[model samples]
Target: MIQYELQQVTQQYNGKTVLNIKKLEIESGKIYGLLGANGAGKTTLFNILSFLEAPASGQVVFAGQSVFFGRTELHKLRRRVVMVDQYPIMFTTTVFKNIEFGLKIRGMTKERRQAVIDEALDMVDLAAYRGASAAELSGGETQRLALARALALSPEVMLCDEPTANVDVENQAVIRALLTRVNLETRCTILFTSHDRLQAAGLADETVVLEKGELVDTSYENIFSCSLESKGKGQKICLLQQKIPFSLPGFVPEAEGRDYRVYLNPDKIKLVQGGQQVQQRRGVLFGTINLMMAEGEKVRLIVNAGVMVTVLLPVDEYAQLRLAIGDAVTLKLKPDAVEWL
Candidate 1:
């Protein structure tokens, strides 16, 4: 079943168009990751999905029913869905009271609320901190507390805006596991926004990319703005951020000197062998490996050359390279790898 369907949704702020999604369908009981950069309308779409703000011009269908922005009984609908912000605001009170507040508003009895609170806290591994001060919890603990509070309501749909953005690495793993547990146990529909593409790919059932308020057909990273400069001889130079230049084959007449978005697919990028001498090639980028993560049978790496670029290699090949975090490596990008977004 489709949990939510958005048709021709467009949101604006101060007379400027911020979000313009034509059609989006969110199915029931699946986790979705909304991937985008800052100001890419991720939060704006979250607001609309949470029904906190209606679109300027569009239709939002919830659970097979058309939602009339102001006419619908939003209070009842809001109870079935919850939005957790990146940095959750906490009440200057005990953790128990913080979770209890929402339950109280819903007219849950004290005994019932306590039971729900205990279950929520246990789910988030915060049962021991029930009496702890909400303001004094660490970043990860606070985020988990917010999740616990949201869980207390048993919302069918949960919208998390940068759920692990502010947390430490340990907490990031904990939150990710907790979300997976919640989805499996309760089968609640989950939608979260993250700037980290790898993190989204690891967690979400489906990943959606939004660029400049429009959906892009990509989930991998390395989206950059580059300008085409004439290099003569039927070739051109694609300057990344007007700095790092990568050679492009036979240029189009219409694209000359024009700034456009290009997506360098991670899998399409080739990594030079460890023992090979670094040579200055047309599509070669020399960079140090800054980050590495295991993604199933593949190893994902972030190379820091002039700009950070993501590269994915097979686990066997990554093991053969014996590369470390600070190891310098060369990257080769084929002309076909540079896709116009």
Candidate 2:
């Protein structure tokens, strides 16, 4: 079931357009990862979904009901959809009180309120800290408290905006596990935004990439624009980059333009030590590591050959190789791994 749908949604700020998505459909009971860079209008999109900010011109439909801006009925809808901000705010009170306040406002009975609060605390692994002061908790604990507060409400949809952005690695793992458990057990539809690609791939059932306030294909991660030089046998497309001519088989474009885009999944690229032979019959390119960074349990590496290529591998594999910045490495690209975009 589609829980939320946006049609011709366009949001503006000071007469300047920010988000201009034509259409988007969010499915029910699935964890979705919203990915983008800073200032990519991710937060704005979240606000629109949470009904905190209305679009400049568009329609938002939640659970088959059309939601209009400034409607008193919106408050009722908002109650079913809770949002956890990047930086959670805590009232100057005990953690148990903070989680109980929302339940009290909803007129939950005293017995039920205590039961739900206890369950929420256990869900976040904060049962021992329930009586502690909310303001004195660590960054990770604060985030867990915020999540506990949301969970106490028993919202149907949870919109988390970078829930683990400011937490340490240990806390990040804890939050990720908590989210996964919640989605599986409670069947709550979760939509979360993250700047880390690996985190999205790990936590979300489906991932969407946002660029310049518009939804872009996730394949754009490895897409490269190049002019087609010639066609080889079996309708192979030869790109004009390296003299060795990298050709993709069974892909022929009918268009007349020579310029085209090709996509390669980061996982498809295999990295080998320099001077090592590729085990498979794959196209090999030698390059220097331009940049490398840890993404959760994976390491994302940017290699500079004739063209820049992105590669992802397990952190354990990277550590075993003992690779570092400016290291020379050989990348193996299988013929079937390349796809035309």
Candidate 3:
């Protein structure tokens, strides 16, 4: 198992700053999700952390030791930590031989080598391809082959970059399943990057959002457990040390229909002036504005009532209303906005 700590990691390319992470820590035995928009330094950070590239400054501490530079120490770290690259290499050999490459390099005997190779193949469900040419495999199969090769080494930690990038839908599930099984059955820890939220939601214990190399936020289930769901209650919210309150008009009567489905158009919502619920209660409190825009001639808004409510409004109308960012207005949730959800 390996514990990696990075502080003030920064990188530059062609005079442009590529990454600037202030601090990050990875514990042993946990799967972490690193997500960001394209070109947000995801790959650059990955390269530096995996020891493939150098950082302008800062340090990476692994297992209580600081790794600054030098091939000797870098090679040592490379051997212990394996990265199944997005585009993996395949030597001109059979799949079995490719999987056995690391074992051979590590000087394992023939008996031990075969056992490790077989176990790795079985782990990835690639036993059937043992005799196939490594280069002839499909995109998804290639990724699996890459995993099998990495597994044969039985690394202390594995970093998978875009493992499912070129995979077919069916094979994507296969790869995820294989990765999950390996994480549970083996002692190796995994830190992977994924574009699929649903996949990350299920597989990752913690998801760290990266913006331009810095940690923007980390998602956790309990973060919102205490906040006012409607927040519209505004200053009325109590604090062992907080007080104040803003009264709002009564809730709109439910539209007679199936369930209301107030669609919160992220674009349509604007910060308005006056009657504005306190900034703290901003997320909730929905209402429609008079008239509409290039969009529907009319717009609607609805506030959800949980322990509080979730606010939603139409995009076009919100803009059409010409409402500034802190103004309060009435919400006319249509029959479509509310539902069992």
- List, residue by residue over 1-341, the lDDT tens digit for candidate 3: 44788899899999888899898888877788777656768888888878888898888987779997688888888888888888888999999999888889888999999999998888778899889999999888899999999988888788888787778989888888877887788856787887654456556666766655677653211111121122332322311111122122223223222322122232333424234444534133433332222323443322222211223336664566566433345332232332221
Clashes of each: 0, 0, 21
By TM-score, rank the candidates, best first: 1, 2, 3
Query: Could you give candidate 1's per-residue lDDT for residues 1-341 as a string of tens digits?
Result: 99999899999999998999988999989999999989899999999888898899989999999888774678778988999999999899999999999999999998999999999999999999999999989999999999999989999999999999999999999999999999999999999999988789889998888988988877648988888787677666778777887664323335676788778888878887442335435777788889999988899999987888999999999998898998878888887776776
Candidate 3: give its CA RMSD in angstroms.
15.1
Give residue 9's error in model 1 in angstroms. Answer: 1.0
lDDT to native, each model: 0.88, 0.83, 0.64
Q: What is the lDDT of residue 315 in candidate 3?
A: 60
Highest-scoring model, TM-score: 1
Q: Whose lDDT is greatest here?
A: 1
lDDT score for candidate 2 against the true structure? 0.83
**CA shift of 133, model 3, Å:** 0.6
lDDT by residue (1-341, candidate 2, tens digit) is 89999999999999988898888999999999998867778999999999898999988999888898667877888889999989998999999999998899889999999999999999899999989999899999999999999999989999999999999999999999999999999999999999876678778988877877998765336565666553435344445343334544345576644666666778888899775334322366677898887777889898876677789889999999999888888887775667775
